[model samples]
Target: MPSTEAPTTHDLQATARRVRRDIIRMTAAAQSGHPAGSLSCTDLLVAVYFGGILRHDPANPFWPERDRFVFSKGHATPAYYAVLAEAGYFPTDELLTFRTLGSRLQGHTVMGNPPGVEMSAGALGMGLSFSLGLALAARMDRAPHRVYCMLSDGDCNEGQTWEAAMASAHHRVDNLTAIVDYNHIQNDGFSDYTRYSGDGDRDRVGGWVLDSGYTVKGAHPGAGRGGPQGAGRLMVRAKGLDSSLRSE
Candidate 1:
C-alpha cells in the first residue's frame, strides 16, 4: 500500500510528472484517446489523491467510509487511470493496455471492473447529478463519506448539470463538491463562451442556485493552454476547494 502520510511537494511533483508520462504513453499505445484534458487535469487529480484531500484505500476500494470521486468528464480516462495506477489502485503496467479490447481501462470509465472508479461515466453533464444522489444518500445514512465530481466546461453546458446544481442547493447537500476542467477546449475545438454564460451574460454564474450561498470561480486568463502553468494554476484552485470542503 502507498504511504498514508501526505506527500511532500517534491513527492507531488515527481508523481505528477510520472502521471503525465503515463497519460502520454497509455494514449500512444492505444493509438487513440483523449490526452489533452487528461494532461490538463493531472495536477488537480494528483493533489486530490496524493495531497491527502481524499480518503481512500487501494486494497479496499469499496470501503464504506472511503470518499467517492466521479469523473464527470469521463472521456479523460487517461488522466483518471494514470492517477489511479500511481496511487496503487492498480499496477502501472496495465496503463499501456488502455483502450485495448480486453483492458479494463477503456476510453471511458466503467465502475466495477476498475478498482477505483466510482461511476460508469460516458455521457456528459450527468456526473454532478449522480454525485448529488450519492451525497444525499450518505447524509440519509449518516455516513461520513464525501462525494466529489469532476466536470468539464462541456459538461457544465448541459441542462442536466444546471438542474442537479439547483437540486443540490435546495436539499442543502453540503457533502458534495464539484470541480470543472474549464480548459475551454472540448472534443471538437474551443468552447463557445456564449453557451457557457447562457445568452451573453458572461458574468452570470450559470444561475445555479442563489439559495446555496456557496460559489467559487477561479479564472486564470492565459493559463488555460499554457502547459504546466495552466495545469498548476487550476490545480492550486482545486486543491484549495477540496481542502476547505474537507474542513467543513
Candidate 2:
C-alpha cells in the first residue's frame, strides 16, 4: 500500500544501481558471498520490486494479496537484501549486519530473518517448484497476484528445475513467470565448460519450457526465439534486459 503509481524508468534504474552498490558492500562485509551473479541481477530485482508488478508492503510482508518472489539463486542474497531495504521492508542500517553472527542477513536467504523474503532458499533448483506451488494455490483461490521466480542458468542443470518447469506448465500457472540470470558462469568456472559443454543447451532449457506450453523468457542480450502470446522476451545485460516486462 506504499503507492500505486508506477516508478519511473530512470528512478528504477537508479534504485537498481544503488542496490548493486549495496550488494558489493554487503558481500565484502560477509567476505564469502557471490558478487558476479548478484551484480548481474540487480536490475531485474529492481524492475520487479519497484515496477508495481509486485504487491509488497515492507511494513506488511505477509500480505496475502501481495505478489510473491522467489530467489532460486539464493547466493545472491546480498542483492535481494538491498532491494528489500530500499523498498522500506527494513531499516537500511541493518544492511551493515549482513553475514554477521546473530544477524538476520545470512549468506543465503532465509524466511525467518526479515520482511520481503518469501522463501527459505539456499539449495538450488527448489525455488521454481516452490513458486509453481504458490501460483497454483493462487489459481485455486482465484487470487489476482502473480509469482516471479529468479533462477540462475547453472542451476537449471538440476533435474528439479525441469520437473518444476513441467509442473508449472502442466498446471497452467500463467501467473508464474520465471527469469533466468544467464551469466554464462557458475561457481567452479564458466557454465559452458562446467555444465552445458558449450553446446548451447543453456538455451535449450528455456526451449523445453516453451515446448511444454509454458511461456518462456530469456535475459540473453540477443533474442533468438519468441515466447507464447502474452509472454515476455528480454535480452539481458549486466545493467538490465533489452525488453522486459520488468524493465524500467
Candidate 3:
C-alpha cells in the first residue's frame, strides 16, 4: 500500500547532526556501544523517522493502529534512540542513560523497553522474521498499518534474511517493506568481499525471490542486469520491485 499521508522532508543532514550528537553522547556515556555502525546508519534513521514515510506519532507511540518501525540493525541503538527521542517518543536527555541498569534504551533495542520499539533485536538477520510477523498479523486482522524494517549490509549475507524475504514474497504480505543500509561494511570485513560472491552471483538464488512471486527490484537488477552501482543496498517490498543500490 502507498503512503496514506503525503511524505515530508527536512534538512536531513541537520536532523542527522542532532541524532548523531545523541548517538555520540549515548555511546560515550555507556562506553560500551557500537559507534561506527551507529554513526554510519544514523543518516538513514534520521531520514526515516524525521523525513521519510514513517507514519508515527511520538506522543502516542502505541496508537493501536500505527505504522510499525523495526531496527533490524540492532547494534545501531544509539542512532535509533536518537531518532526516537527526536521524534518525541522519549526525552532526549534520557539518552545519556543508555545501557545502564534498568534503562529503557539498551545497546540493542528490546521490545517493551522503549516506547516505540517493535522488537528485541541484537542478533543478525532475525529482525526480518520479526517484522514479517508483524506485517502478516496486520494482514490477517486487515489492519491499515504498514511495517518498515531497516537492515544492515551484513544482514544481507544471512540465510535467515533471504529466507524471510522469500517467505514474505510467498505470503503476499503487501504491507511489508525492507530497507537496507549498505555502508559496505559489516563486522570483520567489507560485505562485498565477505558476504556475496561479488559480481552479482547472488542474482541466481534471488530467483527464488521472484519465484516466490516478488517483482524483484534490486540495486543489482539480477542476472546480468546489474546497475551502475554493484549490489549492496536492496529494498524489497510486497507489491513490486523498486531498487536504489550502491557500489561495492
TM agreement with the true structure for every prediction: 0.79, 0.80, 0.75
Question: Across residues 90-143, which tens digit of lDDT does each residue of candidate 2 receive?
Answer: 898999799899999988899847877888888888888888889789878999
| lDDT of candidate 1 over 30-122, digit per residue (tens) | 899899989877766786777766778888988888888888888999999999988888898888999998889889989865878998987
Candidate 2's displacement at residue 118, Å, is: 1.0
Each model's C-alpha lDDT? Answer: 0.69, 0.69, 0.65
For all predictions, the C-alpha RMSD in Å is 9.0, 6.0, 7.9
User: Which stretches of model 2 miss by more than 4 angstroms?
Assistant: 193-248
Per-residue accuracy of model 3 over 1-248 as CA lDDT, tens digit each: 22334233335556767887887788888988988778776655665665545777777877878888888888888888888887788888889989999888878888967788988888888988888899889878988877878888767777898888777766766576666665666678655632432233333334222211112121122212122231222342211111221211
* Count of backbone clashes, every candidate in sequence: 0, 1, 0
Ranking by TM-score: 2, 1, 3
How would the candidate models be sorted by lDDT, starting from the highest?
1, 2, 3
Clashing pairs in 3: none
